[model samples]
Target: MKHTIFYILFLATLSICNAQSELVKIEADTTNIRIGEQFEIKISVGETENVIIPKLSKLNGLEVIDSLKTDTLKNTISKKYILTGFDSGAFYVPKQQIFIKNQVYETDSLLINVATVKIDTTKVKKFPIKGIKGEPYQFDDYKNIVLIALLLISIVLTTLYFALKRSKDDQVKTFVPKLAPYQEALRNLKLLDAKLLWQNNKIKPYYSELTTIVRNYIERELHVPALEQTTNQIIESLFDFSDAKVIETERDTIKKLKRLFEQADLVKFAKAKPLAEDITSDRKIAEYIINNMQPILEEENSEVSYSTPVVIVQKPVIEKPNTLAKVVLILVTAAVILILSIGLGKVISMSKTSKNQMENVQ
Candidate 1:
């Protein structure tokens, strides 16, 4: 009898353990939720060993927004689901099932309400549409535009500078120095000799050119106004110079020049032609007088001081600007500056006016 009673007690203990493993419970944070709002639904099962959790995607028109992992404390395992609904109405959380060791267990059904958020109409305020004010003008607003304009101006100025410099260079490249007075007179005489004008029946032209050479040479060598003076006037001037001993020349040179001038005046005004022999002889006399009338150098009677080779240094010759070029450059620069100044003034005035208008509107 005692053994039979002990066996029944062991069977009772096994049934109680199986019943505890099949127990499942569910709870929620709130029974009411606003439309589009979320709530949590937590489920707890009594045991984890050999438990097969049921998939619950949707319940009573409410969607499972998110599902958390199952958490275990002692032998109980709990799971939480984040749920939400968009439509406004009452919703029922239907019985959810949990399986353990192939045995099914269920939780109680629950009710929930979804409604729109309530607002007090009497407390709300109505506002009308407002006019937008104008924005204040700022220099930083046009920083890029101003910078670009200044850059362009710099480029134009630089281009003009280089262009004018290059133009000046080209002009300097083509310039030739003029021949001096004595060298020029000598060259003309040689050319006139080559012409042989008297042999070609051009005695008047020959005598005129010969007299011109003699007059120019006298003026250049002696600093006398021989070309502008009459033949008698030139002779008087030369006689004075000789009496003063200013020029170391013979009176015969003056007489020869006066005779050449008289012959030239007769040929040019009276149309008298001279013989070829007279023309040739006159050319020789003109050259001899020029050579003789040239300035003579005086020798210094001082002791020599040269130890090394003496290097004579001449002063640097500074070239002056051509009058016409200076005038043109000044005029052009003034015009450009005037145009730019006017344009800049207008731009500044416009900007100020625009800013004032904007401020007034605001």
Candidate 2:
């Protein structure tokens, strides 16, 4: 029993000098302490990587209200331990353990006292709160100039892109839009007439104009390239577009155009003269070409509706001023000449008679 007591006392004394683990330090802001005084206690471990903070036990006569820590970095992880108490008394903070690697270390706890600091109620002082002032600026003229230049360049580039796009759009608008089917056909007919090509013995041009008018109409209204198609191809394409019964009536108009074109080709290329009746037939063919599609022009493209202009000019067979006017003017002029000669002869014969009678009587 005596030996055992001695061994325990030696261990206790060793504990007072050094705790159970590796090297660590515990410190307070002040050694003499008072109650209701709040301060910080720092705990550190030596040559270590990992540190652990166990929940601190409540000190006798001290009430801890709040505690907090700070940011930790990987190389040296430091932690701030803040402790606050409101009760006034003396207290001994127990020893703490800091963990390093896998081993444990001990730190001596600080002892502090809390004594009330008396304040005279009659005296009061105000505490001021401060904020950090903004840093002063140094002027940089070149940087300002560069920034303004970049802004101007960006605006100019953006404006140029839009302006170029608008200009191209305007160009397209300036381009002549495609004429309506009947408008094109009529315009072409007017051009054909202006040439008076028939009088020039250019039957081919006359027939060519008629055929082109018809083909141009087909191409526009039907969306077909009728200009490039043969007569047979035209008929075949029309047939394919609709069943026979519906297009059966249109076949005659198609044939009329085909015949007119063929005959014109013959006169132009083969030097054949057309029958007088064929000329009238060609006019009829033109009428038929436009008449057939007039209803369609009204039905489709309702937004910008199209129409065929009526050709109100005199027909060739009508009594043209050239054909009859010269004959009438000649007959009237010859009658006037005959009347003047007869009157002059009568006056001369009467005068001679009268002279003869007078001579005989004398």
Candidate 3:
């Protein structure tokens, strides 16, 4: 019985020594500071095994500026943190728990005092305000020079206009017609296919160009600003527009386009690798959408009987006048008026001066 009791005591002492071998300590640089002043907290761990650091991104009343790395020695590791507080008050840095080898160890909480700068009312003083200064104005300061410059510019422009008018017949007339939106989109898709962008591993640029062509077509054909809209935003705007009009039939096409844009976004942003089948599917969808959305050509309207089953009535299209020509005409007329006004004003001033001289001589 005596031998057994001594053996038990020896085991208890050994266990206590083993537990005390490892130590964890936390130390701070200071305990008090003015508000927004920074201080350091050093955490030291002895006999470090597998250890997990606590997340210290934000404290209740304190802000973490930087967390320094653990300095490793033979059997110990030390970590340093810089923290600050913006409010003036007493605050507690919460206890940090560390996990190691299925066991938990925690640091004791720390208390810190933050104070604001003190101000004294006895040291304040008052001063009188200064008077404002004024600048004298001149009536004809640089006005004559500016008017003369305007007159000269108008004369030069008038001379150039007549010269260009006379030489207009010698210029070649290049009448390049604008391509319809559908034609432009189809041509671009053909060019894209020839390049085989996806096969060449240029997926992002390929999708970007593809989406741009589709957006431009939407803007030109439907007057939608698809280029500047996100996928979700474009869908929402289209749905709103459709509710007001009879455009429910185009919902399927919009959904297909949305899927294509999302897939492209994944490839461009999320680094997704698409299958060959997927690329072919997208191409087919694009082609189908463009073909279906092409502008319909109408033949001349003929008189039809009232008993006809289906009589498709086409609305007459009105063409707008050339806006550029109107703008140029307005600018030319304004310039001519300005020149004539200046000339008349100068003549009236000269006549007044001569009349005054004649009166003085008499």
The top-ranked prediction according to lDDT is: 1
Estimate the TM-score for candidate 3: 0.35
- Cα TM-score of candidate 2: 0.32
TM-score of each: 0.38, 0.32, 0.35
Instruction: Pick out the ten consecutive residues of candidate 1 with the lowest summed lDDT.
Output: 166-175
| Runs in model 3 lying further than 4 Å from the true structure | 1-22, 124-160, 163-362
Candidate 3: tens digits of C-alpha lDDT, residues 98-149? 6666677667678989999888878979677644433233446446756876
Candidate 2: deviation at residue 228, Å?
A: 1.2
lDDT of 1 by residue, 113-134 (tens): 8988889999999787554455
Pairs clashing within candidate 2: 33-113, 33-114, 34-113, 34-114, 34-115, 35-88, 35-114, 35-115
Return whichever of 2 and 3 wins on TM-score.
3
Reference-based lDDT, residue 248, model 2:
29
**Residue 23 lDDT in model 2?**
49
Question: C-alpha displacement of 264 in model 2, angstroms?
Answer: 2.7
**Candidate 1 steric clashes:** 0
Better of 2 and 3 by lDDT: 3
lDDT, candidate 2, at 330: 53
